[model samples]
Target: MLDGTLDGRAWRLNDRYRHHAASEVLRRAVGDPDLGRVALVSSFGAESVVLLHMVSVVAPGLPVLFIDTQMLFAETLDYQRAVTARLGLTDVRVIRAGADRIAARDPDGSLHRVDPDACCDLRKTVPLEQALAGFDAWITGRKRFQGGQRATLDFFEPEPPTRLRVNPLAHWRPQDVQDYMIENNLPRHPLIAKGYPSIGCAPCTSAVAPGEDPRAGRWRGRDKTECGIHFIGGRMSRRKVTA
Candidate 1:
């Protein structure tokens, strides 16, 4: 359902602000009329504080959508509270699936054990899609350094059917994230110290050893990399609609 208009706008935004600093990209995104109602979608995971802090400085009142899968670690929940307070983010909306939906789809909470993708869809994708219905665009913390389909990520992307996805940190390196967090004295996800570089749902996440990919701990033994949120129709969408 993606039309040429959204594609062209994404390309133009990328060309205009691709080389700007992460903070600049974010600041402009908040004020850009073309972007309409923009909200930051954060997991409050490892390296998430960098963007959260940036937004706090530029637009503390901007809506922040945090999807709580209800399967996250206790530490993640606590950290979410702590960080939200520390940043003084006025509009951090906590999103989640309805209780009835969970009872019908995953009553025993064993869906992740049998089907991680289905679990993610039930707990994450569906809830987030519903929560984002009111917004024209959303900001993500994805970086090109994460690799896979994100290796060539740009500053702006069109999310089919309706929505523009903004990645202010697309060009940032790992060192940049580290330096920003350290320089800003931001608190990291508590699980990071326990060897969880990429934190997702508690059931599918594990500890990664040295020399492994930072995200290797996620869905450790599966063929899956991304949670279904970033995917379209069970496949990774790599379309780069540039001019």
Candidate 2:
């Protein structure tokens, strides 16, 4: 279980590594006793390969928790497998919502149509929360360039009651992501060529038009911006940690 000290530790880590490069942040984090047990939470989406590749290089055997909502695109599932094999990631854990929970909450799979937030909680957030219970911190692929609540993301953040969140690529830009993938010869998500810059569950995600936000396709025509995995209540838990 986590205590109040976790927040202080996160703040200190942020201050220590604020000016470090993304690779340095990750290298120090992988085995640093301060972080305890750390895991990488990946969506294996459009830009996931960059961080995934980084992890492969830095710590190939690190625990990688992947939430398979059971509603993802076929291409996403295939890409997950291909990427794992190509990167030689030995400890990729596939997380999913319990069958009983799905039966109780979304029997007909229409929950996304009527209540996307609840659906996201059932499929993504809850499963990830449960999976992350054993770790002191988890790493994410979120970048400040994504805008919205993530625009002010830091390298390390306190995740409320317990746990710390790490965003090694918090300062990376869209071009940085693209350039990294191209320079490293990483495999791109197949759906990207089809106008799906940002991929999520098939039912809620659509294709973005030119000059539109990359995430515009997600929950199109709906007021939902996030899947409830990152936010607490329509906002990130970004309370400043003071000395």
Candidate 3:
């Protein structure tokens, strides 16, 4: 449990670390006794290398949670392993949707065609919630420039179930991510050069052209922008809740 209430602690810490750089923000969050335990949630996508590199520098052994929705692109899986090895991340944990759950709800593996929101709930959101149960705080790679609900992204925010979200790169821009990856010699996700600015599951993700939103390819032709992870509050009720 946190020192005080979870929301209370989150508010205070968000204020304290708002002005700090990503490295310092990460260090303080991991070492913060009040938060109990912390973990990093990575999609291992296009801009993920920047934040993962930072975590490797500050706390290599810190738990890194990767949600393998089982519907991800083959290259994403390969890239996950490659990046983990390249960055020397010590505690990379792969969390997945239960086999039984998938068999029951999506035996055909085509649920995303009918209701993408339900697919995300069963494959990503619920599994991640289970993985995060042991952690007091979790970190994400979301940035303000990502647009949509992420336009107001902050360094820290209090999420539901009393957990704090630490967005170390909340203020980082696209150029910042590109420069960090180049300077650090990080391996780029293979699909990036193939026009995929934002990578997600194979079926729901596509390639974007120049001048398109980095996330424009995700859930394309649909009204969905997120896969039910970063959404908070009443937004949860708006989706098909299979959890």
TM-scores, all candidates, are: 0.94, 0.94, 0.94
- Candidates 2 and 3 compared: the better one by lDDT is 2
Q: Which stretches of model 2 miss by more than 4 angstroms?
A: 1-4, 233-243
Specify the poorest-scoring 10-residue window by lDDT in model 2.
234-243
TM-score of 2: 0.94
Residues 96-138 of candidate 2 have per-residue lDDT tens digits of: 9999999999999999999898898888887888888788889
Clashes of 1: 0
lDDT, candidate 2, equals: 0.90
Error of 1 at 172 (Å): 0.7
Residue 216 CA error for candidate 3 (Å)? 0.7
Ranking by lDDT: 2, 1, 3
Q: What local lDDT does model 2 show for residue 152?
A: 95
